[model samples]
Target: MSTQTASSIEIEAFEPHPGWARQGRQPRIAIIGAGMSGIAAVVKLRRAGYTDLTVFEKADRVGGTWRENHYPGLSCDVPSYWYSFTFAKNPDWSHRFAYGPEIQAYMERTARDFGVLDVTHFDTPVTELRYEAPTWRLTTGRGDEHVFDVVISATGVLHHPAFPDIPGLDSFEGEAFHSARWNDDLDLAGKRVGIIGTGSTAAQIVGEIGPEVGRMSVFQRTPQWMAPLPQKAYSKAWKRFLRLFPFVQTLLYHFYYWYMTSRVGGAVLGDEKAHARLAEACRRNLAENVHDPELRARLTPDYKAACKRIVVASDFYPAICADNAELVTDAIERIEPGGVRTKDGRLHELDVLVLATGFDPTRFILPTKVTGENGVDLEKRWDDAPRAHRSMSVPGFPNLWMIEGPTGPVGNLSLITISEYQLGYVIQCLDKMKRDGLEAIAAREEAFDAYNAYLREGLKKTIWVTGGCHSWYIDKTGMPNLYPYAPQQFRKEMQRPDFSEYRLIHEV
Candidate 1:
């Protein structure tokens, strides 16, 4: 092993404007969720010389998605090197696409190494948040209460699992569970399996267990456009070299970010040439992989490639084409006691049923009753739709910052990179608070409305709206709950806070 460690890597500190020391005292910070974003927040805050912080995690461990999801073949689509923290780069990822366990290990190691695990209160969920002028009150699940000057909600979007609404689903005699809540004790060898939905999770599970299972019935409500995922193992020699010279790994990280995000960003934002190239790649991948015309037609999607979150898999096609696996396109009328009943009067029998129907993406900072200044309820305010100014601040919530909140960039880019950018932006806002000696800060109502209005218009050009497919990205308001701007533009916008759009408060 190299003598140099992640701590040896020099990280630049945020240089607050001159006269930043005019603030009276550092604020007590409470961070909800010990996920990747929450871990990033703690690291950045401490690096910026703010040590008064505590992290509340509902689980017994860190690594949110990676911790919760552990089904077969669960892996990140983003490259391993690029899907890591800039401060702590891993030189020994097993593959280009890191598996869920590997990613979870990375997260735990990062938290342990950076001292995040020490300050984090695992198994303590924040149930309520109430703004009391300059300070905020946080109530935990254990009936414990804490006061803080600032609260950061890093509660991720995809934490809650969403099961299918098929009738008689609960009546299934077989062992059934959502993909997120996988039953590790159950063995799958020679057992018949039935998977519902054709999203990424279902694709991954089918690809891994198709040959081993006696039979597999994949219930596809809609076919997904699969992009070719080329995974390569990192050689031991390369790993050693990366360990010796970490800067090379950093360079590779930036290169991957630029390469991956540029293609995805352009394609989703209605760039004609980029969209065409991406669509052709997906179509060609399907055509070349599945040769049978009947099977190919069943697997082909009616919508555009980037319309829904593109499923990335190298083994899914071949696994589905295997004799043991059958892709059922018939509409599922209801789940029966022993199997699934389709509208065609066919019953697909199974020993195990897995619902990979995905999560409720809109439940950010929910189940936590949050009351802002002057008796403003966050749930009621966003009854129509979830909206945040610049994806971080709400109009009524003062001294509250959200990382990867509503309207955040949700493209094919690595979420690690996006969360880092948002953390940097949040740090800048906090620094500004100190410089101004402000008691609290919130986004202006007009600014929040205008920013969402701009997002509504910008989404019109994106593939999510015009690509002729319904996706989870669209909110109840018939608008996309994502940032529609280019990746470069997002980075630029997050570099600093636009103070004019905020409502800064100070008491006499």
Candidate 2:
């Protein structure tokens, strides 16, 4: 690939191969999710000469999470340099941490520029995915069924918003909604707002609404550890330099990746010194922003860093300290007509309610009905706790690959990197199938079980499992199905196709 600005590239329509028109022999692949990861898969596969492909997106547009979550103050915690796809780096990042709209626009542009949009089926959600004897069958929400030789589930975990099932949640007379599904019609000017669950979304929303609302009551179950974000607009000179010197840009990306991945390792497996330093920095950040001792104490996190995601914002603590905002640490008992009632029987009056609770990360590629061999449901097979070999292939699901699958990397590291790596692996598998005339490829049961056990053992030592905090990363059984501590080791394991770990059935 040449070193050019993402905007400079023009997308051309893909022409079908002569073999595609043949009576019975071309391989077809269906990719679910037209997000960054899914687009990456389509681009890579097309470049590798797999012409028969289709991308299905549930929404009318591309950019999965970015297209869905349009809440105020919504932005990526990761730096823009690392957050984007490596193959298509943007030299013109406005902020160090790009906002949702900008990121969404980038994805949309990527799809358009790469011709993935032409092949993508928008406003279509896959209702059912079944594996026939030799091909995978898919049913859309519109009651249309299609078959493919292989399937790739790039449908990410974060897109599905998980609302809390609190008592009397439905009876709240006030305008209440999840942060993912922000209600734009409800005006907050001079209106009291009760925000629930001070996670990343809650922090961002509170900061955004604090200056506008009459009074902002932020409800917190556990305080999040926030870091200072060095967010600033990039200069035109910086973009020029990045474009002129591609090597420098690569070096910069590597430096950021190494630094971030090292921090993840330090938090998950390194000595206590690193964790303590991070904790001290978090405390100093909180103390500097919040003047009141009570408020500072309420904002301090008790668990270890990386147990739950560490938020990055320069304004969140300061916003909470504002006169209009008040942080309530007490558990919410129920939703009264006017406001929320805490466990201590105190009714905090509010006009609007915002649930900033996070997404359902444990339920990987969920809500999409996927059936495998012999009409076996993928959900029932996993039993709500999905497992995958190298977070790619399931035991019984043949020729089905999942990018950013269960137990895949979740923290600090760039998801773009994980997606690229997974896509590469999937393409390689397809290449092998084409070369060897294989009909299907399924993970060996022993290898799948062993990989899951290894992942479980690694999670046992991490702060996400041992720490006294509950997060979306954990399943109902409390297993951490996100990232592992040794990301590099995992990457190396996925560098090539491990045929021994999988069962490859040749075409008869």
Candidate 3:
């Protein structure tokens, strides 16, 4: 038998149950990862009247990143009102930036209330997905095989933790772990703590635990552009008023979305004035906060702001300025049994070592063998670089969609809002399939290539490409693997699916 291209494939349509009529028919949908995106899919699909769906999660619970990272002072940099679901807004957020636990609890409550928990397969990870014309065969970790008409991969980017490769890293005698995999059992109070990587997670930890820890050493490889958080709690009256008049909460959500997207979006998109203003704010924050000239200079970032997703924390500078906290700018030589040894021949002793190194952004829904038509492997296709058509669908992958996938807009803005937009587009495509009696649909290769080309050209105008700093956003191809346009443009693009861009397979 000869293999067929996506455009050339045609297959038998889903047959309706003999007992049930055509109106009662529904496609079996399998959504991977019970994180925010997965939960959003469940709620949105169920409400849209598609009930035959199941979520497979590796972890025992919902809330992907939030559930994983429980480090102290782990709150969202985005405003709480904007970070939450647009459909289900929480009026009672304790602070402007919701804590990790609060976001996790919100996810659980959303899942529970929306009946997602019932349909979700907890602790079950999708090991592989194979497209066998018309349908997708899903293999779970338990060796269970399930076939579905459609599969949506909601496995997020930050789930896999990236560890720093240093000689004798394992030789450290003290408890060591990634920031995402925080050890709740260990008591950090009065303990000599050393944090590697001065990313957002490390800054948050330093801000929260610096005062209490006996001695804190923050090993900074590169300085991050620090932005003022200006986080504050909601008053009792404000909460009560929002609960009474929910429209006010909705108004606040839109306001925040506009504020963040326009400001941050413009800055990254090479708006010189906007970028300069933002960079100035960060510089002013560092200079005004850090009294010592040397410390201020050490804290200042040489690259353009928004290059590495500017670390937002009002308390970080103050925490670093504290008497107990010491910022070590020296390069790390190796890790001894007791602590981290720098190239300056200074050994910093620590009782606990925290690796605040972030995740490998490229490993989204990867390591899972996804074979499309003609046994085209997704991993191999993306071996050099990962690219998805408009950040949702891939070429040759029929009846499959990815939420918050490659080339999606991810930065200081709220991802929940972006995921919702992407989901809206996915649902529309699914609707077309159900309505038009289609067996399979994949992005046209020409269309995929064109869209990706457009993204690369647009990225040329963005700071991610122009900025001198190295960031996870830039893939090996020297192209930033994210939406480089403004959020409004992204929203406008996702507003409607261009049917011509897809290779739709009609049922035989």
Candidate 4:
């Protein structure tokens, strides 16, 4: 974070969109998850004059992953300036990359400040969502059923833990937990810890506790593209300048936004030379951190860069190379009574086993039984792969818009920004519905097919599929789940909503 002075400018109040509020009769809206996306959905809906909004957050708190996953050294990879909501620009962020606790607090404050808590239902989990003609019936975990005119799915993809099914995992007597389901009570100051998976979560955990632990064994399946994190504390004076001068905050956001999109984003967009250059940089960083050539080779990836999620951390390389830490590249044979067995017949003992295995990205919305027209279950329909028109709606699912559907992992951009744009698209649809006196609306089947077709063609052009690597981004059917265009191009497409592409009707 730079300590330069910012020019003070006059700040103006933000106004609600024109005709955003309902006219004669308001529609009842229920938003499924109050995480970043759900919070964005509700915040935008409220600002648009949609007073009848209910945000259902399963956890007692407002933040999603930020609230649930209390893993050590938990911080966002994206810069703090770009990660926050555009409407609620936070100028007092302590670090360049805000950690989990501060971010959760920020979201909670935003909810309270925006009057979202008034209509939000905390500790309420929507068990099932059914669309009966014009209304959506949502059944909660408490057996309470509520009906709404529209159902917005803001439940994030990475909220659920995806544990690997190693043999004898259940028989392990040692204390074990997923990174998302971290046992806060379990102390690991001087205990032996075995963490499975070298993803971002485990990378962060290793950096935090590697120095403190007696012995640390890091299990790796595939090495991620690790990069340096330039995080620094912002001075009080700089924060004051940011707070006093809103334009400076805006400028900072833009700076990070363009910088990230150019480096990593360019690599994903089929730039193999860019990928090789980044790979060399990562190799150099690894070499500088780890003196042993063999250990460095184990840390390197055989696959190309930008194939999987790029993990950013300054201390990861050093953590793994710590005197007490061991990087195990061997494939897991099975789980023993007290430790894990590798293919090389090595039984690593451990007191606490942490599975940082990432979430089920393919599981679009699990455990939520969604029945649309003709009793077509959303879960059953999209079992193999999920699809949505403009990453929002389907042909059978009426008045239902899913944020961050299959068509978006939003490579190389802040997820909050992509989510805000997605919510903007959904809100436009809601505005059209209220203004046109529409009873129900669904994306035309032809439009859905056409969009996915375009997406399929674009995925083949990207490095995710062409590059020699497999991840949650690619579905079972070889369909990569990233937005099928450049970051800026996708934003341009989202800015304009074409109702002609959707089957907007007064009655279904």
Clashing pairs in 3: none
Sorted on TM-score, highest at the top, how do the candidates line up?
1, 3, 4, 2
Runs in model 2 with CA error above 4 Å?
Answer: 1-26
- Candidate 1, residues 164-192, lDDT tens digits: the string is 78999999999999999999998999999
Write model 2 residue lDDT over 1-508, tens digit each, in one string: 1112322322233332322212245568789998888989888888888877788878877888888899989999877888878778888788888999899989988888888876777777888887775677788887877777778999986877778877888888889888888886778899999888887888888778788889989888888998787788888998898888877767777877877776645776554766777767777888888888878877777887667888877888888888888889888898878889999999999888988888877566668887777677888888858788888888878888999888888674588888988888887887777777677789999998888778777777777777678876677775667766666876787689888998878642
Question: Between 1 and 2, whose TM-score is larger?
Answer: 1
How far is 456's C-alpha from truth in model 4 (Å)?
Answer: 0.9
Candidates 2 and 4, the one with greater TM-score: 4
Q: For residues 214-309, could you state the per-residue lDDT of candidate 4 as single tens digits?
A: 999999988787888889999999988987889999988899888778777878887677777777777677778888989887888888777787
Displacement of the residue 492 alpha carbon in candidate 4, Å:
1.1
Which pairs clash in model 4?
A: none
Structural similarity to truth (TM-score) of each candidate:
0.95, 0.92, 0.94, 0.93
Q: Over the full model, what C-alpha lDDT does candidate 1 score relative to the true structure?
A: 0.86
Q: How many backbone clashes does candidate 1 have?
A: 0
Q: Mark the regions of model 4 whose C-alpha exceeds 4 Å error after superposition.
A: 1-23, 272-277
Which candidate achieves the best lDDT against the true structure? Answer: 1
